[model samples]
Target chain A: MRYSGFRVIAEALTGHKGWKPVWRDPAPQAEYDYIIVGGGGHGLATAYYLAKEFKQARIAVLEKGYLGGGNVGRNTTIIRSNYLLEGNEPFYEFSLKLWEGLEQDFNYNAMVSQRGIINLIHTDAQRDAFTRRGNGMILNGADAEMLNRDQVRALYPFLNFDNARFPIKGALMQRRGGTVRHDAVAWGYARGADMRGVDLIQNCEVTGMRIENGRIRGVETSRGFIGAKKVGVAVAGSSSKVMAHAGMRLPIESHVLQAFVSEGLKPFINGVMTFGAGHFYVSQSDKGGLVFGGDIDGYNSYAQRGNLPVIEDVAEGGMALMPAIGRARLLRTWGGIMDMSMDGSPIIDKTHVEGLYFNGGWCYGGFKATPASGWCFAHLLAKDEPHKTATAYRFDRFLKGLMIDEKGQGAQPNLH
Target chain B: MIINHPILGPRDAQEFVYLGDANLMGRPDGMTAGIEAFHDYLYNRDNPAGAHRELWYHEQGDRSWLVVTRNTVTHEILKVEMARDVARAGGRSK
Candidate 1:
């Protein structure tokens, strides 16, 4: 049912029993025109756009578990389009635009807060780099502003301004970058896709792929064999394992990245802030808790839990950034597997197998790229061509030495 | 996590640096095998969810490269061997 302020008042007056389930839990169909594996944010969004935008029919999304149980729910919820590389900047900017209009379009309250994001600048070299980055962002039609040390102090006076080393000199601010209610994104897209005749099949694990001469067939799942004319795999960290079923190896590794939240307190942080010299980035949630995270657990592992050293490192970075938050008690910490690519950028392209597409290698930044990743993957699946903004996330780029290494770290997934 | 070093009894995981999949040690001859072998060596991985043989450098300790056979799911270390020995066994020479 469509929800609105008027509906709320009517339901309140009439015993409030008129609410309906957000999406249908449909049984697996015998066949489908298109099937998207893994019902995370990217998969759900792909199904949503395929039905709504592309007007495709006979679509199905098969999830191993319930929707939103993956990285969609296991993130710091920060969103931004502030990037430097040509292959990445435009795609993320498109995602930011989608986040801007997402709630209204999907008819859900996703809490898309454009409260701004600031990347602290420490050294003069960082200042020069951020200046170039700001110009690049502006060139891509994304908002960017360079804030001096005084300006940054005016915004967040509680920050450690004058440290012996790594003092905050300035900041690169993006007024449109902020956080979203991540779970609502999954629910919104699920509801939108289900409303558009897409079957969202949960508890259905794809066991194997039935490839006849590699020209596309269907998938064998825990439930049964489900036939599909086309198949798209958007499994984030599980991308390598799932694609391995089709005898294709991806340039991706699964690494655990942990996030933490502090106990609820009065809102003090104005926007998302990142430590210039370290890996810590934090933002105050709508529930008044400080949600923060740092670097990934620099190793290859599928375990959804991290070790202690990274935690200590992140805590040290947080302490170095802001001493006031030291007193706040940490409420909880969780980890999500990251699809860290060799080049640190994502890959959203069709594989060597015809009719089988892949979209993964998002590393730790998959949460912010949800909309554009889905939209681009949907465009590729529907039109059999790469989206205009995402033309560079191909598999052959690594072989051609045209990798989109944003950090300039070569071939090291852990470093990326 | 503790890595039982072959020389040193036990070392904290923080004292080492992780370079992914031990397959990286099997560096293909680029001039002889061409781009396909190089691409496979540089990119693809056997990222199993169970026991994984990976390369770790004792950067903060002995500066020795070691191979650790550990379970990815449980983070349990099964075996540790000097990477030089493993590489030598695989027929690599200076």
Candidate 2:
């Protein structure tokens, strides 16, 4: 049912029992025209776009667990398009645009907050690099601003600006970059897709792919066999394991990345901020908890838990950046598996298996690229062509030595 | 996590730096192998969820490279061997 102020007032005047389940829990059909594996945010968004934009019918999204049980719920909920590469900036800018119109498009309260995000600068070299990155973002039609040391100090006076070493010099700000209620994204997309007659089947684990003589046929699942003429694999951390069912190996490794949230406090942090000298980024949630995270655990693992060393390192980075949060008790911490690609960028292209597509290798940045990733993947699955912004994400880029190494860290996934 | 270093007996895992799969040590002969082989060696991985044999460098301890066969699911170390020995056993020569 359409939710509006009048409906809410009417329901309030009555017994207030007009609310219903957002999405249906339908059983999987025997066959569908399109089958999307892993009903995370990207998969659900792809199904929604396929039904709404492409006007395709007979779409099914298979989830091993319930929706929002994966990275869609595990991320720290930051979104930004402040990238410096040609292959990445445009795509992320498109995603930022999608984020701006997402709540209206899906008719849900996602709480898309564009408070802004700032990358603190410590060194002159960092300033030069950020200057270049800011130019790149502006060229891609995204907003950017360079804040001097006094301006940053005026904005966030609690920061340790006077540190003898690694003093805060400046900051690169993106006025439109911020966070959204991450789980709401999944629910909104699921409801939109279900409204468009797309089946969302949860608790259906795909065990294997049924490829017949180099062509796609169906998939073997825990429930039973489900036939599909076309299949798109959008599993993030499970990319390697799932694609292996089709006798293909991906240039991806799974590593556990942890995030933390502190106890609730008064409204403090006005925007997302990243430490200049370390890999610590933090933002204050609407509920007042400070949500933050750092580097990956730096090992290959499928487990959704991290060791203590990285925790200590992240806390140290936080303390080094802002000494005021030293006493805030950590409320909880959790981990999510990251599909760290060889070049530290994502891949969204067709595989050698006919009618089977792939979309993964999102490293730690998958949360921010959800909208564009789904839009482009749906375009590919419907039109059999890459989206204009995603033309560089082909699998052959690695074979041709055209890696989109955003951090210029070569082929090391852990470093990225 | 503690790694039973072959020579040092047991060392904190924080003392070592991770370098990913042990398959990286099986470098192909660039003179004979084509770009496909090089690409596979550089990118493709058998990233299993169970036991994974990966390389770790003792940068803070003895600066020795070792291979640790650990379970990715449970983070339990199964065996640890000096990477040099594993390389020699796999028919690598200077």
Leading candidate by DockQ: 2
Relative to the true structure, candidate 2 reaches a TM of 0.99
List, residue by residue over A54-122, the lDDT tens digit for candidate 2. Answer: 999999999999997999999999999999999999999999999999999999989999999999999
Model 1 bad stretches (over 4 Å): none
Model 2 interface CAPRI class: high
Clashing residue pairs for model 2 = none
Pairs clashing within candidate 1: none
Candidate 1, Cα interface RMSD: 0.8
Candidate 1 lDDT over A240-303, as tens digits, reads: 8899899988888899999999999898997999884789999999899999989999988888
Tell me the DockQ of each model, to 2 decimals: 0.86, 0.89
